[model samples]
Target: MSTFTENAPGVAEQSPEAAAGFTLNHSMLRVKDPERSLHFYTHVFGMRLLRKLDFPEMQFTLYFLTRLLPEDSVPEDPDERTVWTFSQRGLLELTHNWGTEDDPDFAYHNGNDAPQGFGHICFSVPNLESATTWFEDMGVEFVKRPGTGKMPNIAFVKDPDGYWIEIVQPDLTAGLGR
Candidate 1:
């Protein structure tokens, strides 16, 4: 393994002063079919649709979804829900460009192909075995299965748009023998 030298060049600074009020809000991905994408995310991954905004002028729509814990309370009012959704973390934003679903060849690069870029989004399930079994029963495609890969405790599933979603159990990963 290579260690960082004293004068090692950096792409970004490691200064907290430059990021005072910063927090990771969400990550966005473009989907070809909004309906299929929404169904896959909601039913398969168990994410709730927090908010959706349609822009007729731009010919696009934005769908924001998040995993709401059992103890979390969602506000009833639209204004309150909007504020609460934005203030929370681990949100997933899906962008649908209007008319793309009509084009049979329309597909977004999943960023894990030849020229790899963005890899995947992950979810930490309470039980790895049960979660993977549930995913298998739902007919979800798997890129990597737990106990088959170098990291036995982690698995990867593909969404409708072919984007990878890594699944792991927090307790199991601690004993990976790293």
Candidate 2:
């Protein structure tokens, strides 16, 4: 298990004085079964399982996968194994820490659409139309379609695990929509 501290030393020194340039390293999601989530992410979306670690001592497994780059292109540094590569875009980290025998297998549920606390992860696509169509063809259900006025030129889709993802056309509001 990895521990993340928001106000860590170096992380708070990247800005002038007390202004911290905090960067999001990754989002950790505890899953009941890593294999099941892996299959869902791989088959549904085009994500590749980059690496997996079986910590017998910790009694858990950590699998890092992403849609940014192929698994073979990942660096050989074990320390940096958790780092994912993207095509000029940030990468996502899907964490599946093994649950205990008493832990309940909670299915994914859409949380309140807010930026507070830990919410759903959002991804941007080049074309929202094609992306939505592709997801629909795969039998994926979306929580909302575009044009609700919540987010212009953007649509929201959910994964098999019910994790929300936002698909938006790049630069949708770049003067053209105005």
User: Top TM-score: which candidate number?
Assistant: 1
> What are the runs in model 2 whose C-alpha is more than 4 Å off?
1-23, 69-72, 76-89, 99-105, 108-110, 113-117, 175-178
Predicted structure with the largest lDDT when compared to the true one? 1
Worst 10 residues of 1 by lDDT: 1-10
* C-alpha lDDT of residue 174 in model 2: 65
TM-score of 2: 0.65
Q: Which lDDT tens digits does candidate 1 get at residues 1-178?
A: 2333444477343445666667677899999999999999999888999988889999999999998889999999888988887888879999999999999998899999979999999999999999999999999999999989689889999999899999989988886664
lDDT of 2 by residue, 93-178 (tens): 55555564245666534464444344567666777788778888877778788777656587777665567777778778466433
**Clashing pairs for predicted structure model 1, backbone only:** none
